[model samples]
Target: MTLPSGKWRLGFDIGGTFTDFVLHEGTTGALTLHKRLTTPQDPSEAALAGLDEILAMQGIGPGDLSEIIHGTTLVTNAVIERTGARTGLIATEGFGDILEMGTEQRYDIYDLFLPFPEPLVPRDLRLEVPERIDASGRVLAGLDEAALERAGAELVGAGCEAVAIAFLHSYANPAHERRAAAILRSAFPDLAVSVSSDVVAGIGEYRRTATAAANAYVQPLMHRYLGRIETALAARGFAGALRLMHSAGGLIPLETARDFPVRLLESGPAGGALATGLFGRAAGLSDMISFDMGGTTAKAALIEDGQAAIAPEIEAARVRRFTRGSGLPIRTPVIEMIEIGAGGGSIAAIDEVGLLKVGPRSAGSDPGPACYGLGGTEPTVTDAALVLGYYDPGFFLGGRMALDAGAARRAVARVADPLGLSVEEAALGIHKVVVENMAAAARVHIVERGRDPRDFAMVGFGGAGPAHAVAVARALGI
Candidate 1:
């Protein structure tokens, strides 16, 4: 893709709670920012809405933008919510259970009842064929055409829109996988197929297989979303080159992003890290830790010497937030970071043990927080913040959207009354709990990288990041 010669560039990041924008005028190096509530029903709506408002307010038009870089957490959210398109997996014979078995190592040794994220492709949808390739890429048995065809028929019968092909040793030699994909595509030309080698090249069977499955799971959804966004932009006379932010704090074209949606999983969070790193370098800081708190979750990453730590493996949709190996291990190029389900819209409730706890659950943007007065009855971090006097109810969203303080107090009372604590006390408790949770996560996150939290300077961005950055930093003694 090529960018046209123009004086303006536009960028947007789509998050669970809000969509953020940045418009930069190349001529004067001036920048403008904007935010909008995310439209979950159709994410493109929020994106286009924000783009139009920003351009119009800044006295610019679509033709003035030479480039647009967009990123979204939709792919990762789909995996977490199990809301992607119907997907099926094809594996070598006797390996259909690889996704479930998952290396047989316990992520938490002491926690007996450990919960694992459900496999993207269920057991019944995972088909097997008579094909074998050894560890070093030796084909011990040839591909079984009849078995493959039978599996393809089963998948088609199951109404699978996407199929993932991950035969054993495909990373070393992708011959069998390529053949399987060809066979399936020939049978169903419209089916989206993701081969193991083409998605992620790795030696681990479970990681490679899971990665391919994730790509297939979200391929159809991402394809439709990107197509819709492009059409909307084009209708507005935008002729700029479109690019997507990736997990490694880099950009990729639309075609590559559509084919391998797995790489876009952490795209939005990576953008924060990159921006923080740049600002840190300009200030001549040695080690910078980036913190981004959005609507659905909070994330922290380490940047040293102007580079964010990246890994070839990432775990998605974790059952236990802080525990390692509890989620689907996707082998992709991802910026290394620790993420938790604690965020502004995270729901607060009392567990059966009569203890108050924050979320792995969220209210999202549709209803949003109770204070938003958008039909949400549950207490969220935003509501708690309102109760604790951290936000001006009348001036919320820069007065564009007013908040209801009475609703926020009532929502927080649910947790407060249960523990016989005052509403303000409960609200403060909620903030402390979430901050402690993030602080504990950050401590572990930095420790894993052979670094101390006190050794790094922290930079918090995003809508919710700045609000609690001080407490988190104090918790880490940074």
Candidate 2:
């Protein structure tokens, strides 16, 4: 399987809200854009369907395909929703509760009821083997063979199809982790095992171990998803190899993805940055911010001098929207961005103080906004956009999904009357609130990095980003 000589490179980004397809013809430098409703049930199905439709429209066959670059939020969703396989963690004795203990830093030091994200692996599912590896990567206590056997048996008995083995300081010394993995493999040859040292070599024990655990948690799902995609592509007469875009905005072979599934956590956002980078260059902008508001979340990244900012560590599934140390920290190369639940489908309601509040909870595409007529009675950011004139009810998604403005008004009215504001004012307030939320997040992220928002131009994409960019920029005082 190889790429064709032609300049036909296809880039597909399967976002939480929409599946975007871009066909770039090397010959003419011409681009064709296609957007389709995402099929979360099987995201690859939407990709395939979108691919076929675009190929048909361009009158090109599979033979004309040079390369296909794809990205999705499948791994992120799996981890955030806790919908991955029943997984287990294997650690050195006395350190089995590392993940549970975490850094022990409170994001809200003064708040009494500070909530924490649940550990990916439960305590009972976290098995400890009789082994000790010091911070210097030296084995102070050798692995107890009998204890390993018993732990493996217990994990297997607990129905752990996948297990993560993260020994202390394994990044510096992997001997103990390697030995434990060997023992587990010998005992349960079919079980999937992930080691922290190999996945993330960064310092910070909790983040490294958490990253590895998250990887193991989603490994089986990624394997099945990628395999299914390969099969579907082969059946479609696309004989070329399939490459997945990683969170770092580079294409990695399927083998790499299968082994380090966690790297794809921010894959979808990476593609958006790549797209934004290309657009920025074309538009003669060197420094810019990429704002992507999809269905499930809103992602923002800062791009300076035609390069997207990248961070080596980021938290996932944060309990608090803007709080640091409030989520599982993963040590991986990812485009630095802040994600908030302020997407088009973000639910809007009134807080306890009778003040209108926008979301960190989304309606998703299943029921969608009340205007979608998909049985969703909740008022969403989309509904607010419809009422605020930012979205033309008849021209949304190029008129693919007809919206009911009346429904949106009614949904907004449910919360508007209590706030003593008209439906239009309430909808506008919702839009303002969401935009400010994104702007505030960007400001904090940029300032914390010792940069200024004014130094970056905002490059907006996704369904709602373009609509809210101006307001968000104004709110940021840019």
Candidate 3:
């Protein structure tokens, strides 16, 4: 495939721990790939750095690229970390409480103390306006313009950087929400605004409102982030279409992604699904499973009939982590998958009852694993793997960075001392727990969809997936 180069298509993916790059020659079938540690300080920097390095390797420049496709965990991380802009909500007078009371369906009937996820807009910031619309798209009462202005001004005065407008029956009749958004924009042209009907107009009030609120919360930030990337890429002589991969299994231009950032929530995981489906078909497989374990989390998806399964909706930032109805609901088409807080950087520690537990918390790329020697003290999956002699300290990452075996042993020993076991024993326990967690989650996801795991070929990718694939496959009886 080493022929004269044609036009180039460059792709970059920003995961929790690494930014991966792939450079493809249009007609020559040549490709160059690279992976660099992620810079959480500003993920764009990592993208640029990786791009430059890949260009140098390919003997090309930014101007030689015909297009750029980028995807990242930024929007999802904002929702999970609650790091987006301060946002307010505007609702119909009698229906403002919908922000708290959902469809009145219990996600878990046996758990009495199940907690609801916090609304993006707090109670004090949720203002109500007098308006009514029937389910049949007829306006029962005209919008209260004075009330709308008052709510907008109150939100502005409350220091809200963004606002969500969700009126009763807006999916059927968006007049009220549209007017409300217009009024707010006229009052404060700079405040980021989102209307429920504009985001999801199909059905389900709670899911629609929650999705719009989530979008508004991240709208300004996403807009600015994309703008920054555009400017930076332009400075590097990149003058091609800049597209972002969305959760629904395809790519959308930057503007579309900015308008509906909530749609980007599963973009990273969706890539894994798309790739698995392609690989399965290329390998003459009819059914398969994709396992992607990144730096912070692991995701699993089922594939059949040469397509990845898709779900109608998803929950974001669940308080209890994996329980349904415990987080903000978003009713968007998604390649159905299950995600768990277990990965290479997943922390291993003793629970309250002194039981060894793998993560719901990750060390991420910052102070990554203790083996990175970046000041991380917690015992993570990477440290456990090192202690188990799975890696050669001198050759990790092609020796781009050295691994610290002493630090890995010390970190695993920290967990070992509490469990009254040797470091090697504790490391084995941690490894088993990590693999079990992933297998258990994947099994539930497959079983719920009425499938047999043993019938599907497992396709594993990502930083840690291949390393632990055999253990996970055996645990799942595949």
Report the Cα RMSD per candidate: 2.2, 2.3, 2.0
Between candidates 1 and 3, name the one with more favorable TM-score.
3
Q: Order the candidate numbers by lDDT, best to worst.
A: 1, 3, 2
Show where candidate 1 strays beyond 4 Å: 1-4
Clashing pairs in 2: 7-26
lDDT winner: 1
Q: Which TM-score value belongs to model 3?
A: 0.97
Worst 10 residues of 1 by lDDT: 1-10
Ranking by TM-score: 3, 1, 2
Q: What is the C-alpha lDDT of each candidate?
A: 0.90, 0.85, 0.87
Model 2 whole-model lDDT (C-alpha atoms): 0.85
Say which prediction, candidate 1 or candidate 2, comes out ahead on lDDT: 1
**What shift in Å separates residue 34 of candidate 2 from its native position after superposition?**
1.6
Which candidate should be chosen as best, given TM-score against the real structure? 3
Candidates' TM-scores? Answer: 0.96, 0.94, 0.97
Write model 1 residue lDDT over 1-478, tens digit each, in one string.
2333777899999999999999998878999988899999899999999999999878777877899999899999899989998999999999999999999998778888978888999999999999888888898999998899899989989999999999999888899999888888898998999999999887889888999999999999999999999888898888879999999889999999999999999999989999888999899996999999888899999999888888878888888777788889888888888894399999999999988899988998979999988899899999988888878888876787898999999999989998999999999999999999999888887897899989899998877788889989999999
lDDT of 2 by residue, 1-478 (tens): 3334865778888877678888988878999888887887888888888899888878886666868888988889888889998889988888899998998888888999989999999999998878777777777888888887888889889999899988777887888788888888998997888989889986878888899899999998999888888888777787665688999889898999999999999999898887788888999998788888888788888788899878897788888867888888988999888874388888998998887788878887777789888788889999988888778888776776688999999999988888888999989889888887788888888898788888777777788788888888888777
**Cα lDDT for residue 440, model 1?**
89
